[model samples]
Target: MLTLIELVGIFFFAVSGSLMAARRGFDMLGSAFLGGVTGLGGGVVRDLILNQSPATFAHPVYFLPPVLAALCVYAFTPAVQKLHRLVQIFDAAGLGLFCMTGTMKALENDVNPVTAVLLGVITGVGGGMLRDVISNVTPDLFNPRDVYALPAILGATATAFAWHFDVLNIAVGTGIAGLTFVLRLASIRFGWSVPLAAGHWHRQPNIPNHGDGPRRNF
Candidate 1:
């Protein structure tokens, strides 16, 4: 059950990474590198923190999907970039699956519910962050306060709560992941977003203008 979810996530994430590379005009090698990192990086971090072997390292077959995804993108070229919406859908799927899997694994290792949810969020966003960093862009989840991480965290927390109550079987996990996926897709379709913080640099001070001052033109 665990490997099944992980494989689905790996495939989705790999495709997302390849699509990004395609959009950015990266070469075959670059696309492969990005795909591999995006597909495996988060799971590797989660496994190491849990004191277990990374799936990609332990099962060599786990590495094949990303490589295949990258090659497909490279072969398709600009045509693949035309279907940009497909990328977003797949990315959401990846986020949902990865977050749940991460949370479940953490709980299996006897981690507290809070920590498990945190790990879930990490697994959900970590790959995209690494992908953006390598591609010379700010991570979208943090810089702009996107709805990405929030949905993942919400789903993870729900799953954790269920697990705490001893009701978190594979079915419940899948449902939680599905909820996250739907929310993510809805966010994209409806232009939903989290409000940005009022940074000091962006705040405008209210200054009183005396009658002596000329009124500003609209």
Candidate 2:
């Protein structure tokens, strides 16, 4: 079940990446590359930080989902275009699952709970960050448009709490993921946003505020 969750999460992340690629008028190769990066980048970073082989490299089967996602987007462009608005939802789901997987892996490695939570949030958002960077867009992780990291933080905290209580089973993990997913979607649905920096730091007279420009989807 955990393996299945990871695959599904990877697929969700791949969908977001491929969809973004398609939106940017990228070709098949671009779509495939971005999809694979979004699907496996986070876990690879987590593994590397933990001084282990990336799971995607060790289990080549994990490559299938991202490839499949790219193909789907390539072949079904029109359908995908219509559902593009759901990209955030797809990302949210992946964020939830990845956080759980990361936290569990960290705990398995006997990391302290705080480190586990930090790693969990990193695993949740790292792939998306890489995707945005590669695509030359601002990462959603830093976007002030919505409550992004909060959900992952909450989810990771929940997972750590569960682990502390020795009840970190499949059901609890799934529930925590679901909670994160719902929180993310709800934030989007309600146009929820976190407070931006509050100081009246003055920009240079000639310096333009990019924040006032059109908001680009990451």
Candidate 3:
């Protein structure tokens, strides 16, 4: 069950990366690379932190999804580009699934609940961060106007809570992940967002006259 969930998440993430590469006019090799990184980077980071071998290396089949995703994007670039809404939906699904899987894996490894939730959020957002950085775009996580990380945090926290109470199972996990996915989509659809930097909200107090001449924007 866990493996299946992870693979589905990977495929969705790979599709998102492939779409980005296609939008940027990347060649086949670049598309494949971006897709692979977006699909597997987060899990690799999680495994390394847990002192386990990365699953993408351990299971050769894990490499197939990104390659397949890239090929599909390359073949149908126009159609795929026109389906931007669908891509966002898949990305949200990937975000929810990865966070749930990451939390479950951490708990399975005997990690504390708090750490598990943290790892879950990392697993949810890390791949997208790497993809954005490599593609020279701003990461969604760092985009103050996006609610990307909040859904993942909620999903991870729910997973950890369920696990702690000995009530986590495939069904409950799926429901929680679905809720997370919905939250993400709703945020995008409704323009829901976290507040921007504190400075953006609150004005700095005026400096005293003893300060240098006219106060300038910092």
Residue 14's lDDT within candidate 1 is 87
Tens digits of per-residue lDDT for model 1, 1-218: 88978888988888888888877778888888888888888899888888888878989888887998887776765575475676677789889999998998899899998999999888888887788788777676866635788888998898789888999887888899899999999887877777668766776666677887765644
Cα TM-score per model:
0.85, 0.87, 0.89
Q: Please count the clashing residue pairs in each candidate, in the order shown.
A: 0, 0, 0
Q: Where is model 3 more than 4 Å wrong at Cα?
A: 79-84, 199-201, 204-218
Model 1, 42: alpha-carbon shift in Å?
0.9
lDDT by residue (45-141, candidate 2, tens digit) is 9889999988898888899999999998878766555655756878898999999989888998999999999999989999989988998988888
Question: Which has the greatest TM-score?
Answer: 3
For candidate 3, the TM-score is 0.89
Regions of model 2 farther than 4 Å from truth: 79-83, 200-218
| Candidate RMSDs in order | 4.9, 5.8, 3.4
Candidate order by TM-score, decreasing, is: 3, 2, 1
